[model samples]
Each structure stands twice: as C-alpha cells, then as structure tokens.
Target chain A: MRILVVDDMVTMRKIIKTQLTKLGYTDITEADDGTTAVEAIKIAVSSGQPYDLIISDWNMPNMSGLDLLKAIKSTAEIANTPFLMVTAEAEQKSIIEAIKSGVSNYIVKPFTPDTLQEKIKKIIPNPVK
Target chain B: MPIKVPKTLHPFINAVEKTFKILCFLDVTPGDPIIKNHKVSDKSISGIVGMVGSKYIGSFVISFTAECILNIVQKMLGEKYTEVNDAVSDTVAEITNIVFGNAKKELADMNITLEMAIPYTIRGNNHIITHKTDGPYVVIPFSSSLGTFTIEMGMEPKKKDRRG
Candidate 1:
C-alpha cells in the first residue's frame, strides 16, 4: 500500500519509516512539511494513484497536520483516505479536535513499534483484505 | 526562599523517563536532584520549553551531553552522527517537545492549564544557559547508558546576560 509520512524532523521520519517497513509496507513517500504534503496529495488524487494511508506530524513549519487533515476531509476526492496523526502533542483538547476533524487514529510520540502497529491495525485492519 | 517542590514535578519526571525509554530504548530514572545551579545549560545540547499554567508558570529544560544526544539520534535514525549538526539539534528539540507534551497532558488533568512554546535548543561545550525565573529552579538529574542530563524548571528566565 502507498503511504505518505510527514514530519519536519528527519529522525522522526526515519523512525516511522523503519516501523512501517517492519510491518511489510515499503511503498512509502515522505514530505517534510504539511504544505508540501497537501500538494503531493492533490497530485496523487489527480493521477488516480491516491495514497491509501497518511501519517502526519501534528506540528510543522508551514501548514500543520490539523489543517492538512481539515483540508483533506473537506475535499470529497481524498476525504475518505485513512489518516493518522503522529505527534508529540497529547493535549486532550488537541486530541478532541483531531477526532472531530476525522482522523482515523492517533499515535502519540515516543511510542513503541507494537503500539504503532496497534494504531495502524485500528486504521487498516487486514490491508491485504 | 526555595519554592516548595510542586507535586506536578512527578508527572514531568515520568514523561522524560517514558519518552527516553520508548524513543531511544534507554531506561532512564531520576537521580538525586541538585538544588544548586541556577543556569539550565549544564550539558552540550539543551532543549527548553516554556509553560504558563494557572498554578505554575515557568519553563522546563532538558540538557544532554554531546555523547548522550548523538547516541540518541543514532538510535532513532539507525545511523551515526559524529558531531552536532542541524539534524541532531532538531531531534533534540523534538525529544523535548515529546517529553513536554506528555507532561503537559498529565498536568492539564490536574487543572493546571499549561500552554507550550516551541522548543529552543542550545549547543556548545560546557556552556551556561541563563533563564530568569521568579523563584529558584529545581534541578532534577537523570542517568542512562548514554549519559546523564538534567531537567530544570523555574518561574521565569534570567533577566539579562543570557548565554548559550
């Protein structure tokens, strides 16, 4: 499955990529910031090569992951894509906002690979199915 | 006078311990807290987060030596970094963000609303970090296989002549 990982930090991006690879997902793309992620998402939809999953960092330099989620959910074309928020912000209010914004799942930072797998399973149960 | 140690400090400690364990695969626990040393910059790389809460208003800092921090980045990226670079600096900031974010959530449950500022980083060898706080800050030391660093908190930053 095609996936997009968004984070300004290369370390975090690499960690997530490693965990995803361990889960047998190698078709992954990455964007450093939310604005670039938006552009990439729009292009993917246009080419009919839509990403099956999107894992984004909550805070970023340009657009934030929350805004990107809102933008994605508002557009009918990419609204249904499974979106997960990977962030260090564990505030209840922020979490509520993401839930309200149609985030499929949320993974707080400093999480173990098992926990990451659990959240992804919650989003895509049986990707092969 | 020394401010009474706030009960909120426990959650902050827990946050740091847990974050290091999960992210760097290191087991970190609190060492004896040093009541002295007003400056927060006690290591090579330090990341600080400012907080404004109802009952507490101050900033928290995490300071690590170059060896400790570089080891962490290497573990996270599955690569080696010999010297301090932008990537190492940014990773340290991200770690600070995660530790602070975890603590902020726990503290919020206690009715202490803390607004977090984007983390700032300081890099140097044996440099002093100055933040003027309203009260004497509490310095809690922690040790891991990588090295030892301190987590400091206070009411306000140092007024003038802030260095590293």
Candidate 2:
C-alpha cells in the first residue's frame, strides 16, 4: 500500500518508513511537518495517486499531525484518506481529540514493530503482507 | 489518590532505555544517578521538556556529546552527520519528548496525572541549563554503542495551596 509518513524528526520518519518497508510495502513518501504533508496529500490526490494511509507524528514543530489529519478530512478530495497518528505524548485528552478528529488509528512511541503492523492491518487490512 | 513525591530518577531512566531500544534499536542501560550541576559542554546537545501537574513540577533533560549524538542520529536517520547541526538536533528533542511522554503515561497509569510542554532543544559547548528546582540535579548517566549521554531530572512537589 502507498503510505505517507510525517514527522519533524527525520529519525522518526525513517523508523516508520523502515517498519513499513519491513511489512512488505515500499511505496512510501515522507513529509517533515503538517504543512508539507498537506501539500503532498493534495498533490497526490489531485493526480489520482493518493496515498492509501498516512502515519504522522503529533507535536511537530509547525502544524501538528492532528492539524494535517483535520486538513485532509476537511478536504473532499482526500477526505476518505485513512490516517494513523504516532505520538510520544500519551495524554488521554489528546488521544480523545485524535479519535474525535477521526484518526484511523493511534500508536504511541516506543511501540513494537508487531504492534505497528497490527495497527496497519486494522487500518488497511492485509496491507502489502 | 494522593500525589507521591519522587525520590529517584528511575522513571526517567526507564523512559530513556525504553525509548532508545524501540526507536534506535539500542538497548540502553543507565548507570547510577549522580547529583551534579546541570551544565553541559559547548559541543553537546540537550533536549529539555518541562513537567507540570498537581503532583509534580519540574523538567527533564537529555544531554549528548557531539560524537555521541551524531552516532545515534546516524543509526536512527541513516545519515552521516559530522557535527551537531540544526537538522540532527531534532533527534534529541524527540528523545526528550518520548522519555517524558512515556514517564507521564506510566505515572497516569498509577493515577498520577502530569502535563508535558513542548520539548525545546539547546546546542552549544559549555552551556548550562538552569533547573527550575534547587541544586543537586539528579543526573543519570547512560551508555550505548554510540557513546555516553545523561538524563537529568529536577523535580519537586507542587505547592499545596495552588489549584488550577
């Protein structure tokens, strides 16, 4: 499945990309922050190359992952895009907010690759296998 | 439930170990903590995050030498960083966020609620990060294949009279 991994930290984006690649998916793109992620999503959606899923980190420097999710969900062109949020913060209020914002899944930092795969499967069943 | 004052930096240490193991694929074992000045060298990177809640108020900092930080960044990002630059320092900040975020989640599981602020990054040689709390900062030294780093925590019980 085509995926977009967004995080201000290149380390984090790399880690997610590596894990996704391990899961048998190679069509992955990246964005450093929410603003760029929005643009990438728009461009992809406009070109009929929309991503199957988005994995974004919360608490980035500029706009956050939540903001990107909201932006995508608000746009009719990409509103159906599935989103997964990754965050170091475990605040229940923020998790609730992401849920309310319509995130397809949520994973906290320090999570195992198996857990990540499970979340991916739930979001996009049998993703790349 | 009542708030319990922390007497050790174990939570922060565990947070560090857990974070690096998962994110960088390194198993970090922290050495015994030492109470020392919260100063860092000019060629070091520090990730700082403030902790505030009804139970506790303070900050968490992670310090890394230029060589040490570049090593981990390369491991995590797969890029060679010769010096501590603006781009590579984001690793320290995310490490700070993960350490503090994990600790706060652990505390919340036991009914202690704490709030975290945005993590700030500091770079330079021989610069000092002043702790909001008193002296004798709890500095827990840790080592990995890359190099050595320290996790400093300054914590204090919240004033009883304050309410938010």
Candidate 3:
C-alpha cells in the first residue's frame, strides 16, 4: 500500500518516515505542506494509483491537516482514504473537531515507535507487509 | 535560588519535563525558577514559538548549549553530531513545537485559550531573545543526564483582563 506523509517540519517528516519504514512500509511519499499534499493526493488519484493512507501534521504552513482532511472528505474520489492526524496537543475540542471531519485516527507528538505501530494497525489492519 | 513561579508557568514546566523524557529518553529535573526582565538569552541554540490567547499573548523559548543540544539530538534520533547544522536546527524547531503544543492543553484547562504558530530556530553565540510583551520573563532551568537547558516564557494580558 502507498502512504503519503505530510508535515511542515523536515525533522518530523524524517522521524515519521523512519518509523513507518521500520513498520514494513516501503511505498511512502512525503509532502512538505498541506497545500502541496492536496495537490499530490489529487495527482495520485488522477493517475489511478491513489494513496492508501495519509498521515498529516495538524498545524502546517499553508493549509492545516484538518482542512486537508475536510477537503478529502468532501471530494468523492479520495473521501474513503484512511487519514491519520499527528499533533502535539490533543485538546478535547480539537479532537472532537477532527473526529467530525472524518479522521481515521490521531496520535500525539513524542510518541514511541510501538505507539505509532499500534495506531497504524488500528487503522490499517491488513497493511502491506 | 528557589523562586515563586506563577501558576500559569507550570504548564510550560510540565511540557519541558514530559517532552524531554519521552522524546530523548532523558530524566529531566527541574531547577529553580528565575524571574527576569523583558529580554533574556541563553546558550548557543534556541527554538522560539509565539503564542496568543484571547486574553494574553506571549512567547515560549527553549535554549540549549551546543553540547547539550547535540547530546539530546543524538539520544532522540540515534545519531551523533559534532556541530550545529540544519538538521540539528530542525530538531530544535520540532522540540519547541511539541513542547509548546503540550503546554497549550494544560493552559486550556485553566480557561486560557492559546493558539500556537510555527517555531523559529536560532543558532549562534549569545543570541538574545527580546520578547514583545512588557511582562516579566520566567526562565526555568532544567538538568538531565545528557546536559542542561532552559525555557523562558513571557505573557502580556490585555488591559481588560485582570489575570495575566
């Protein structure tokens, strides 16, 4: 399965990518910001090889992960894709907002590799091994 | 020196302890809280993030010496570095983002609705951070097995807000 990781911070992107790699994921792509991620997702869908999973940071430079999730949920073509939201803070209000926006799962920052794997497993039970 | 830290600053103190422990696997011990003037600078590298609330606005800064930062990064990413570079600076920004984000949650529990923007990383010798607010800065020092670091915070409450 293909995955797209979107984060504004290079370090975070690298960290997540590394963790995902260790979890047996090889077909992974990265987008620096939410705007770019939207374009990338659209391109992937148009090319007939849409990403199976999207992991995005909640706070970004251009568009936030919530907005990106909303856009994907509103668009019929990519609405079904699984989305994992990464954030540093998990306030109740924001968590409810993300849930309402149709996020598959959410994880807080400074999480361990085991925690990441657990969260991913909950979303993608039969992910590419 | 043992100083009386404001209750508002406790969230930040908690953020630092939790972030460092989880991310870098370091046992961090909080030192005394030093209240200072409007502007303060420490160490060689710093990650600064600005925060704004309906009733208050301020900045949170985390500073580390070159040795301290490098040690922390090595433990965090499982990589060693001798000098501060773009990658190291990027790590600093991420740390500030996570720590501040963690603090915002507790602050919200106290009825303070604060929004966090991206963080800026500064590197050099004795780089100064001049906060925009007129409020006093609270510089809290922390120590770990790796090294030492400090977090400075300041907030300016609006005129109508009695509790800053």
Candidate 4:
C-alpha cells in the first residue's frame, strides 16, 4: 500500500498525491526530483518499509524519471516494484525507451482520475475495495 | 516527397485549446500555423520539452510573452501577479506540461506513442532554435483573450540509420 510519487513541480506533485489519496492509497510519499526519489527509495528498502509502487515524472533536475526507473529496476531488493511513468512527453521513441527500461505502465499528462484509477488497477496487486 | 503530417496534430490542437481554457481561462481559436521566414525571439517566456519517437526527433516549444504569462498566472492562481515570481514561473512550466501531456494521449489513439522529456523554460529575447536535420517543422498559432501564443514543433521523422 506504500507508494512514492516524484515530480519537480509542486502543484503537479500535489495534484497527483490528491488523486492517489482519493483512490484510497494512504501510505504515500513525495519526492521533488529523481535524486531525492532514489535516495528515498533506498532508505525505504533498508528500513524495511519499501514502497509498493513508484509513479514518477520524466523531466527533473539531477536525475530524470527514466534514470530513476532504471536505478530501481537494477537494484535487487526493489527491482520488481511496480513503476509507472507519468509524463508529458508522448513521442514514440520515449515510449519505446520506457518499455525497454521495464516500466509497469505509462500515463500521459492531464489525465483524469478515472484513467489513473484504471491504470493503477492493472498494475497494483489488489483492489482497495 | 510530400512529408506525411502525423494524424496526431488534430488531437494535439484540441488538447491545447482545452488547456488554455482550463488553465488560462481564455477562449482560444486555432489559426494557421506559420513557419516564420525570419528568426523569432528565442528569449521569450517559453516552455520546451524534447520529443523522441520512431518517426520524429525534435523539440516542442510553447511560446508566450511576458504579459501573456503574467495574465495566465494571475488567472490560474486566482490572484493578481504583476510580475513573474517563482510561483508564476512554476505555473508556466506546469501549464506546458499539461498541454503536452494531454496531446500525448490523443496521439496514442492513432498508435503514435510519445514520452515527455523534462519541461524547461527559456528566458530572454531573440533566442534562435535551429534544426540541422531535414524534418518538417510545424508552428501552430493560437489566439486568446489574454494574447497570442505559439506552439512550435521542430520534429523530423527519425531516420533509420540514426540511433534513437
């Protein structure tokens, strides 16, 4: 039930967190950039409170979402954590790269709560009902 | 050879229109996109994200004037922002992200998948963006109550030999 949401924009992070909360996810954490997201993930794993899922933005200072996703997948402890990339870039090349990098799912920007709910259901192990 | 315009252009236009209405609260009408024969300012209040795909490799830019940015930020926050502060600058970046993100979904329906790069803002005047490659550049212009903004697309279909 623990999830991590990463993005540089404060408003966007807030909006996505709000949506996740509405979807009944209570154990959520936020990171502003890729570096922070990575650090947070590492700390969580070591502390035995590993995140169940990660939803990250593409562009960020220091490290990007793709880099963060790659980092997560490479680590043995949290490699299988369901990771979703939420970004504004919808070019075919980026999509292919994300797939190659092993993203669990991908969603574009300005998406509705319903779209998010559907995507999460597909990836999350169990429904919150 | 006549270049094929990706079918995603229409939905991209629709998404742009919707974003303007929701974020800027301005009614927008799409006009014919013009490719300026002369150099345009690269130093405007613009947000840009790079798009890489099987068919294209280039950047998408959303250009606005200082005045236009101020107006939109003020509306978005429901407060009067006379100048570009941190909040206003962040707002501008978020606005472009939303516009591009929405367009990506519409494009996906046509099997044209894309991923968003990080969104960055260009500050200054008379900034020039040159495309050394031989792909089609699309410049879309929109008119709104606050002012006019341009969505400049400089994507060339990816060549087979080039590594993505």
Candidate 5:
C-alpha cells in the first residue's frame, strides 16, 4: 500500500515512517507540511496510484492538518482515502473538528507502535501486511 | 508586583514522564523542582513553547545537555548521533510539543485552558530563555539512564480576569 506521512518536523516524520515500516509497510512517502502533502496527493492521483492512506500531523507551518483533511474530503477523487491524524493537540475541540471534517482516526503523539497498529487496523481492515 | 505561580505543575511533570516512557522507551524520574534561575550549561539545547490562556500566560521549556540529547535521540532512532543536528533539534521540538499538548489537557481539567503554539528549538552553550511571565520559572529536572534534562514552567495570572 502506498502511504503518505505528513509532518513539519523531520524527526517526527522519521519516527512515523519507522513505525509504519515496522508494521510491514514498505511503500511509504513523506511530506514536510500540508502544502507539500496536498501536492504529493494530487500528483499521486494524477499518476493513477493515489495513496492508500494519509497520516498527517495537526499543527504545521504552511497549512494545518485540519485544513488538509478538509481539502482532501472536498476533492472528489481523493475524498475516499482514509485519513489518520497524528497530533499533540488532544483538546476536545480539536478532536471534534477533525471528526466533523472526516478524519478516519485520531491519535495523540508519543503513542506506541501497538497503538498505531490498532488505529490503522480500524481504518484499513486488512492494511497491506 | 508579586507573581502567583500555579497551584500545580503536575501536568507538565506527568506529560514529560509519559512522553519519555512511550516515545524513547526509557524510564525517567523527576528530580525535585527549583524556582527561578536554573543554570543551563554550555553545549545545551532547549525547546521552548509559549502558552496563553484566559486566566494566565507563560511558557514551557525543556532543556538538555548536548551529550544527553544526542544519547536519547540515538536510542530513540536506533542510530548513532555524535553531535546535535537538525534531526536532534527537531526531536526536541516535537517532544516539547507533545509534552505541552498532554499537559494542556490535564491543566484544562483544573480550569486552566491553554492555547497551542509551535515549539522553538535553541541550541548553543548557555542559550537564554525568556518566558512570558515576569517572575518564578519553576524548573523540574528529570534523570534517565541516558542522561539528565530539565523542564521549566512559568505562568502568571492575567491582570484582568476574562471568562472564556
């Protein structure tokens, strides 16, 4: 499965990539911010290999994950793709906004790989094992 | 004017412990806290974040010796890091962001609501930190098998109370 991980912090991107790799995922790509993530998603869709999943951080410099989620959901082609928000913003308001915006799952940062695996499974019943 | 510190700093303390345990897979014990003027040594790095609320305003800081940070990052990423680099700095900022986020939730339970802000990373020998509040930066030190680090929190109630 092709997965896109978006986070402004390089360390966080690496960590998420590492965790996804450990979960038997090899086709992973990364974007530093929401703007770049949007470009990547569009390019991937045009190339006929749209991402299977998008995991993004909530707070970013260019565009926030919530904005990115809204953008994706509004676009007909990529709207169906499952989105998982990984963030440090655990506020009820933030979570509610993400849910209202159509995030498949939300996980707070500093989470374990087991927790990630569980969340991923909920979104993708048989994520590329 | 005397600055009134918050009644509890357990949120930040608990957040740091949980972050280290889950993210780095290392157990950490917080040392006794000190008020104001904690010494940051040479070759140290810190991640600073400003927080604001209806009732108060302040900042949260996490400081580490370069050696300690390098060791922790190496352990976290399963790679060898001899010196602090962009990667190391990014780790510190993200860790601070997570800790602050966690702490904000707990603080909210105590009727303290903090707005989120991105963290900043400063690295050098004895870099200075300026918090939002005027007085009383509470510094809590933590020790792990890798090394030692400190977290400083300072918040003073706003001059005029406003309900959110």
Candidate 6:
C-alpha cells in the first residue's frame, strides 16, 4: 500500500520511513509539513498513484497535521483514505478533535513497532500479514 | 487522575537517559528536580516542542551551553562540531524532539497521549519558559562525560470532560 509520512524533521521522516520498510511496506512517500503534504496528495491523485494512508505530525510550520487531516477529509477523492496521526500531543482535547476530524487512528509518540503495527491493522482492512 | 510527582517524573528522566545513550553514546544519571527559585543562566540553546493528546497539554524544553551543544551535535553526527551553525542548531532540535517523543510514549500508559510539534531551537542566555498553568516545573538534571544538561517539563494535566 502507498503511505505518506509527514513531519518537518528530516531525521524523524527517515526514522518513520525506516520503520515502514521494516513493516514490509515498500511504497512510501514523504512530505516535510502540511502544505507540502497537501500538494503531494494532489499530485498523487492527479497521477493516479493516490496514497493509501497518511501518517502525520500535529505541529509544523505553514500548516499542521490537524490542518492537513482536515484538508484530506474535505476532499472527496482522498476523504476515505485511512489517516493515522502519530504525535506527542498527550491531551484529551486534542484526541477528541482528531476523532471529530475523522482520523482512522491515533498513535502517541515513542511508540514501538508493535503498537504501530497494531494500530495499522486495526485501521486498514485486511492489511498484509 | 493527577500524576503523582515521583511517578510522573520517571518517564522524563528515562527518556533523557535513553536519548543521550542512543544519540550521544553517553550514559546519564538524573538528579533531583531543581524546583527551588534558583536562577539559571538562560544564555544557552533552548529547544521547544509542543505536546498534544489524551491527558496533557504542554511542552518540553532542553537547555544547554553552546559548548555542550557543540559536543552533543558532534557525537550525533559522528563528527566534531567546530562552530555553531544551522547544522548544529538543527541537530539540537532533532535531539530534543527524539527525547520528547520517547517520553511521551511512556506517559501514554498513564492515559496520557501526545501529538508532537515541530522542534525549534533558540540560542541565547537568561531565557525562562513558564508553564501555562501555575504548576511547579520539573527540572531534571543529568551529568555525562560530554557535559551536563537539563530537561525541563512544564505540563498541565488533562482534565476529564464531564460531557464525555
């Protein structure tokens, strides 16, 4: 499945990409922040390589993960795409906001591969074993 | 439930310990949190990242001396930092983000979840970050062979919503 991992930090993006690869996912793309992520999504759809899932961070310059998620869900073509918000925001209100925004799942920061995989499986229908 | 001071503080210490070990290849031991009204020179590099999720709305700040920061980035990049520049600044921010991320994970079990914000660094002296709520700040100090550093956690515990 094609996945888009968004974060402003290069090291973090690299870490997520590495983890995705370890999870047996080969088709992954990256964006540095919300604005770029939105553009990337548009391009992907225009090229017929729509992302199957979106993993985003909450705080970023230009736009944040919450904004990015809102943009994705507002668009009909990508609205159904599974979105997993992986962040270090440990507040109940933020989680509620994410849920209200239609996020498929939320994973807190410093999560292990096992937790990430579990959330992915729960959100994606019949994910690869 | 409010986080018990001691229990709530352990994860932060562990995160700092683990981060130094992994990134700087240095061992660390956390000292008592300096909560007294002692003054610390703010003329150090400060990296701040916001946290959002199930039970906390706060941020983490890592402050260190310029020389100490250079040493850390040197270790992180596997090379010596000759001067302070964008590369060193970026490295410090990344290190802070990693440590915060690690700490957030351990705190999750206590019904605390966090969304990470972009990491940004400031270089100067005599800077102090006050928590939004009038709560005591937990200042965790660590000593390592490279140098000494501190992790300051300014957080307000999440309050359960009655409607939910």
lDDT of 3 at B23: 77
Which candidate would rank higher by DockQ, 2 or 3?
A: 3
> By the DockQ metric, which is better: model 1 or model 3?
3
TM-score of 3: 0.93
Q: Any residue pairs clashing in model 2, and if so which?
A: B41-B125, B41-B126, B42-B124, B42-B125, B42-B126, B43-B125
lDDT of 3 by residue, B1-164 (tens): 56898888899888888888777778888888988774646588999998888998888999998999999888888789999999999999999999999999999999998986888988888687856577578888988888889898888786578754
- The lowest-lDDT stretch of 10 consecutive residues in candidate 4 chain B is B35-44
TM-score of 4: 0.68
Ranking by DockQ: 5, 3, 1, 2, 4, 6
- Model 4, A1-129: lDDT tens digits are 888999889767766787787788888899998888888988999999888889998867788889999998898987988898987766667789999999999987766667888888889757553
Docking quality class, candidate 5: high
- TM-score for all models, in order of appearance: 0.90, 0.86, 0.93, 0.68, 0.94, 0.67
Using TM-score as the yardstick, the better of models 4 and 6 is: 4
Relative to the real complex, the DockQ score for model 3 comes to 0.77
lDDT of each model, Cα atoms only?
0.82, 0.81, 0.88, 0.74, 0.87, 0.74
lDDT of 3 by residue, A1-129 (tens): 999999989889988988888888889999998888888998999999999999999988779999999999998988999999999977999999999999999999978878998988899987775
lDDT string for model 4 (B1-69, tens) is 433434556766887888766544578887775554433554357777777766667666778777877
* Residues A1-129 of candidate 5: C-alpha lDDT, one tens digit per residue: 999999999888888989988888999999998988888999999999999999999988769999999999998988898999998977898899999999999999889888999999999988875
> Any runs in candidate 3 off by more than 4 Å, and if so which?
B162-164
Better of 3 and 4 by DockQ: 3
Q: For model 6, how does the per-residue alpha-carbon lDDT over A93-116 read when each residue is reduced to its tens digit? A: 778999999999998665656777
Interface Cα root-mean-square deviation for all models? 1.5, 2.0, 1.0, 3.4, 0.8, 4.3
lDDT of 3 at B139: 88
Q: In candidate 2, which residue ranges exceed 4 Å CA deviation?
A: B1-8, B37-43, B158-164
TM-score of the candidate numbered 6? Answer: 0.67
How far is A115's C-alpha from truth in model 4 (Å)? 1.6
List, residue by residue over B110-163, the lDDT tens digit for candidate 6. Answer: 766676656787766676554444546667777777777787766776666323
